[model samples]
Target: MNNHVAPRAAGKQVFITGAAGGLGAAMARMFARHGAKVFLTDIDADAVTAVADEINRELSDTVAWAATQDVRDEAAWIERLDQAAKAMGGLSVLVNNAGIGSLGSVEQIELKEWRRVMSINVESILLGCKHALPYLREAQPASIVNISSLAAFKVDPDYAAYNTSKAAVAMLTKSVAMDCTRQKIDVRCNSVHPAFVRTGIVAPFYDALGEEEATRKLTRGIPMRRLGEPDDVAYAVLYLASDESRYVTAAELVVDGGACAI
Candidate 1:
């Protein structure tokens, strides 16, 4: 990606889930900085509202609206998208970034918790695509950036639910892309797999371990010898969301600091 700023996404309309803090907020800022009008959504209404306020103030050149929804709710998806469309005039990009982490083995995880994780992490993707694809088709040459984790390609005994959920996200990205091709839609779908980024999403992992231990564990196998920045993933998202990735679809963009390569 270019280091200097240019309005690559000028006049675009973007709707992002989990847009309160961490990577979601980072991507929202990046999109706005690139000149797209953004709609920020999160289950945490106050946090998302604060996020929208911050973005509006910080990036006065672009526009943003805020909404809150449980991503797992199909009705919420429809209603939120309707409001987002009206707020932004149209929808051009959808970022399925809302998700939660689960830290337990299958035997250790309760069935209800497993279902809850699945609902938030996986079902939400289905709901987003189902509700957004129609409007996305109307706004052709649009993009969907699904935030799958590098855990999808990895495994840990204590993270079965999260691993499974993210793995579903990875495959669903491809399926959505192929289906769009079949229907001859110009919308592209892709997933990003970020490993050990220093974001609130990884806070639980850090808290489970102390700061020093958590840092060591998270960065243990990565070649870069450090955790990733939110901007690292956000830049990749910006590229995917912009017209620059027009030819790219049904792909996994790994921002793992070369850990996957190892």
Candidate 2:
């Protein structure tokens, strides 16, 4: 089998959220490397700017830009996306990768924490789709990839808020896809469900249990017996964002290590 990955996203203009580090940063780099211009955003102004600078420096060109954004804020979404579309000349891909995880069983979790998780993980996607649709529709053949999680399907009792929010995202993706298709729009929407990727989101697991033990514990249920790399999920996002998946929408692309199978 040939292992070469083609530059499938050439000429695509991508907007990624939570792009300071981890999967968001990885996706931004992958898109830039594969010939797409990426506009990255995160709440951390300094870190996101640094990430954009690092990518430009590495590529020796300005294929990437960064801005500070709070995904839960509708006004911020409108402003940031407008700036990004202007910077990139157009926006063809919007990756809703910004999200937060909440730990605690339903009974233990407070209302504020639940709302926080929902606002970031679920409502943000709604806002992104609502606001980005105009730009995406103008760019036709555009795509929106929402970063959900395996927990959406395979739930963990302690992560009640996170599980509920991601599940909502999966359904919301389908709703958006249906709306676009019903209107004969070329914009596509999809959700990615990744299992235990090596990003800051999972850093707590390593901190709670040292890396060695954490890896073993986390991998015990995974058929591949390993944690996923950032690129593993990034590649999935790349496919969904690129024209390669022009016909794929309202789909959940699972990047799990066969954990969801059983």
Q: CA lDDT of each candidate?
A: 0.92, 0.94
Positional deviation of 16 in candidate 2, in angstroms?
A: 0.4
Query: Candidate 2, overall lDDT?
Result: 0.94
Query: Which pairs clash inside model 1?
Result: none
Q: Kindly list the per-residue Cα lDDT of model 1 for residues 1-116, writing each as its tens digit.
A: 47686688877899999998999999988988888999999989999999888988986643888988999889999999999999899999999999998889978999999999
Q: Candidate 1: where are CA atoms >4 Å away? A: 1-6, 204-212
Candidate 2's C-alpha runs over 4 A off are 1-6
**Cα RMSD (Å) per model?**
2.1, 2.0
lDDT of 1 at 75: 92
At residue 30, candidate 2 shows an lDDT of: 94
Candidate that scores best on lDDT: 2
The TM-score values for the models, in the order shown, are: 0.94, 0.96
Q: Go through the candidates in order and give the clash count of each.
A: 0, 0
